[model samples]
Target: MGLTVVAGMLVVVGIDVTAVQLARTQLWDAADSAALDAADRVDEDRVYAEGLHERVPVARAGVAEIAGRHLAEERRPHLVRSWSLGSRTGSPDGESAVVEVVGRVDLPIVGGVAEAFGGGVTVTVVSRARSQVR
Candidate 1:
């Protein structure tokens, strides 16, 4: 009986861990897409005035807005019970777009248990993209 109980618990843990990994991967994909989209959207005014000699310039507000719109419009994974854009979702430099996505994973069995301790399993993914013109 003891062995059976231990085996079952282990199996549950394995499943929950797999779910977390899947959720993290999905979040990462979404963040990457958002970053790429934002990077492609250069400041048109800057480009028109300065011209992109080497790299395109990105505005922090524009990058955040674009990334937020992409994340809001993009399809989310079912494993991610809930998610939100992180504060780091903006351009670190004038030429790059950085996106951070934070999500809570839905565990099949131990979700409640984990939540009771510290709000369940949460995952964060960050992605960056840059555009250059030659």
Candidate 2:
């Protein structure tokens, strides 16, 4: 009986950990997709006026808007309780799009009690993509 109880507890813990990891990976995928989408969105006004430089110029506003839209539109994993745009979602060098996505994951077994107490693990992921004139 003791060993059976221990094994069952271990299984529950393993499932919880796996759920959190899966949520993190899904969040990362979202960030990567958002970054890729933002990378292609160059500042058209700057490009038209100054011509294409060695690297495509990515505007901060464009990156933020694209990332935000992607996050809003894309479907997220059920394990993820909620997701929001991180502050670092922008173009750092005017050439690359950096996207940061943040979310909380709820464990399978303990999630109910923890959520009732307003507790959950936070996950954050950052992804970057750049475009070149070539």
> Highest lDDT among the candidates is held by which one?
2
Q: What lDDT does candidate 2 reach at residue 114?
A: 84
Model 1 agreement with the true structure over 13-58: per-residue lDDT tens digits: 8998888898899999999999999999878888889887688898
| Structural RMSD, model 1 | 1.6
Screening candidate 1 with a backbone cut-off below 3 angstroms (N, C-alpha, C), the clashing residue pairs are: none
Q: Rate the local accuracy (lDDT) of all candidates.
A: 0.87, 0.91
Which sections of candidate 1 miss by over 4 Å?
A: none
| Pairs in clash, predicted candidate 2 | none
- Given candidate 2, what's the lDDT at residue 51? 93
The clash numbers for all candidates, in the given order, read 0, 0
